[model samples]
Target: MTADPSSGAAHDALAGSLKRTEIQRAPLSVAGREIVQVRTEIPPGVESGWHIHPGEEVGYIVAGTVEMRIAGRPTLLLQAGDGFLIPPRVPHNARDLGPGVGEMLSTYLVEVGQPLAAFTEPPDSASR
Candidate 1:
């Protein structure tokens, strides 16, 4: 199934001023799965709130820099030409740390019909 840009967890996250442009969506050879590609523009200092995808996300930074925080892992500082992978259902947040907008291209391999992403509470929130 093709991703619907207007209705999904990804769109909900984008409400925080991130610009998301759908690049492509196509069924994968694997049954019950599809791949969705998106170009995301993050304004400087903005964070993509902790969230998880229904499947894995393979992403590449296209411009600027970002700090990637994934639960149970060391935070990563990434810049243009860098690439990263997020495991399925792993909550993570990406914050743009830059003087200009940060651009990223993400391709998700997800179960058909599932939302691209679902927001979650920060991993450390319960201790507060």
Candidate 2:
């Protein structure tokens, strides 16, 4: 296993300028694989622009609420204790629906050298 290679570049490219803390990160026991655990705080009404992950993302809502919309799915409103998944390379977006800030804990299974996420334009509905 090797050290995590994410260097905050993905967060810098996030749409709504959310704050992120790397809670736990380590390369998977398997060669060339890694798992990144991050806690993100989204300010009220802020939305992450469309983005895609290089790998699958599994997340848990920890505080407040969020509206998550994947390219081809209806918006899902998630509250604390809720869980969600974003499939690899699928474009999606999210917004904080909060009286205060919204928080979430997320884990990603990615290739060791891949960026955590990549910003992108929303996928056309017809092609989604």
Candidate 3:
């Protein structure tokens, strides 16, 4: 497929919106294990709140640009074709940094019954 000239770039745009679609979900052979695949679209300036997944998450940027922040790690600027992994319970968040909507496909390996994500208090608020 021919990539759009602007697919991997970020654009200056106002805060927009996010949409998610579940591609698939299935139970794994390992007891209590499950896998989930999802597609997400984030409009300019939209961001997921600081949160954690109950399991490991791996994803690939499909289009546009995303800014990701993971605890203790340098912020990442991901573009189309970029891929990433977030370990279970690691706090992180992603924002669309685009002139167009940012898109991604994510797969998660998790324990059955665990919620997909859990929002958390900011680091400074933890001590309160």
For candidate 1, give the lDDT: 0.84
Candidate 1 residue 11 Cα shift, in angstroms, is: 3.2
Question: Which candidate leads in TM-score?
Answer: 1
Q: What lDDT would each prediction earn against the true structure?
A: 0.84, 0.80, 0.76
Query: What does candidate 3's lDDT look like per residue over 11-70, in tens digits?
Result: 112112356666677897888888878777888988877778778999999999999888
The best-first sequence of candidates by TM-score reads 1, 2, 3
TM-score of each: 0.87, 0.85, 0.81
lDDT of 2 by residue, 6-49 (tens): 75422436623787777667888778888888878899999877
The residue-by-residue lDDT of candidate 1 on 13-78, one tens digit each, is 445578887778889999999998888889999988888988999999999999999888888999
Q: What is the lDDT of residue 104 in candidate 2?
A: 90
Candidate 2 similarity to native, TM-score: 0.85
Please identify model 2 stretches exceeding 4 Å from their true place: 1-11, 126-128
